[model samples]
Target chain A: MVTVNGEQKNAAGQNLLAFLKTEGYEPERVVVERNLDIVPRDELEKVVLEDEDVVEVLRFVGGG
Target chain B: MEQERKLSKDADPEKDVQEGKSLPDQLQIEDPEEVKKQMQQILSKEELDRAFDARFPKEMQQKFRGARVAIAGLGGLGSNIAVMLARSGIGHLLLVDFDTVDVTNLNRQMYLVPHVGMPKTRAILQILYQVNPYLDYETVQAKVTPENVKELFGGYPIVCEAFDKPDQKAMLVRELLGQCPESTVVSGNGMAGVGDSNGIRTAKFGNRLYVCGDRTTDVGGGVGLTAPRVALCAAHEANKVLQLILQEDS
Candidate 1:
């Protein structure tokens, strides 16, 4: 189980892009940090999650 | 100070009495001397600064004057945020925006009717100057991109992200946090709609970021984006900047 925002989840096998979609977060509106390192926006599809990995997903909603 | 009566030093009271000039002393409702006194006292910049410093606590007045902050996107959020910070007598402000003041922006933004066609940076600076003429302002009339964000805001210790689109906001937050390690960013996320005003708040994250909004309301969702809600969120963002500045010593 990988941790997403300090919570354990069965997301180790999923790629970052797919995990963001399944969690209902718009990929364009979020910045992901995998194991304390920022995963650049263009490289979200290439990064694969691993067990015991800690991820922090920060989402920005629409509006000013 | 209202200019009700004309100040004519050369008028002859004797000639007016003979010619039946009707503007007598008893004809005015307000005290003419009081009005003259109010009009005569023009505040110099030092006096204005003193008046402003009286409102701020003693320990933080110098910090407010020395603080330098940058704001991106001069729409509802950035315009109002600039006004607040300028009023507090901030020393320097780097204003960035690529749009002109439109008729639609008058309802929520700080621009006036005559400022419709002017660039947002210039129009907002005019208002900020009136708020505090002592402030030093640097304007860049260009759009913010991920590639240029760091170059534009690298020197500012604090940056405010006030973009309208979610993607643009995310891009700014990501770029700043990634490129400028010393910069602290305050952003407005979801401040549309007339929801509970209390729902709008400043949420601090990981010491470098503070977002002020409900974080759920979307402008496109059609709940409505009113001036009061947007200004409330701006106040939260401005206050967070002030709070960060105040706590820098601690």
Candidate 2:
């Protein structure tokens, strides 16, 4: 199971860009980190999610 | 207190298990619902377990009653999560915290008037006893540093990270993930501020990680942590803990 934005989903074998598109992300300006390393914009289509990957889509939101 | 077992440490698990194994004996008793409804002020350990077990499916209850979970930090998130876990009949809990309860914490954390100066571990134990007296709990009142985080939380099958600060949460999550591969960490991340109550949620991260709360709402960022949101996040963590227990091998 690959975890994306803290939620585990069947994203292991997914292409990062395709996965993000399926998840309703516009892909204009989103920062995605897989295994704590940033995946560059061009690499989103090339990066295939592995079972051991931890992907977090960081966004700017206010805290409590 | 540095550390101690509270309330039910004296509870004889051998006898409790023996009595619980006699499942057929419960079938023999007539008016099970009435008996369960009438069960107030539990007098014996057997009655206590029976009342607690009545609401759960026998197999699920057995799994819940046999599991041990740990909560680190024991403040708003940890304290509330511990109480909810005990309510679910988790067999044992390892609670660790070094801070003392203050008037400020009464707003969101689980602490009473007299518990103001009491150590968080002791106060949480006092509250847990009130919720489930038959449940076993081991408490430690000490700061969890990177050096000792693994040793403190390694034995638990499910470890909940409920600290207040980002650094503490980061350190605990990082250490537990890297060092304690055997434990699943259910953490509370963005439950600060009273924004949208519905925004708080539980999500599984990776294989052995679950983080609850809105992933972005943080404390000290023009807002503050409140009771309803924090407790809601705590309940999410507690629910995830129970799910992890019942969903083993699923």
What candidate 2 gets wrong by more than 4 Å, as runs, is A1-64, B1-42
lDDT at B192, model 2? 74
lDDT (10s digit) by residue, model 1, range B1-250: 8765654996655666654323334322233233333322433577876786678786788888889999999999999999999887778999999999999898789988868888998787667755665668889999898789889999789999998899999899888888888899999989888999999988876558888999889988987678999999999999999988888778
How does candidate 1 fare on TM-score? 0.84
Which segments of model 1 are wrong by more than 4 Å? B1-42
Lowest lDDT 10-residue stretch of candidate 1 chain B: B27-36
Model 2 agreement with the true structure over B62-146: per-residue lDDT tens digits: 8998999999988888988888988888999999998998899988887878778878887776667657667788988899986
Give the C-alpha miss distance for residue B19 in model 1, angstroms. 29
Best by lDDT: 1
DockQ of each: 0.69, 0.11
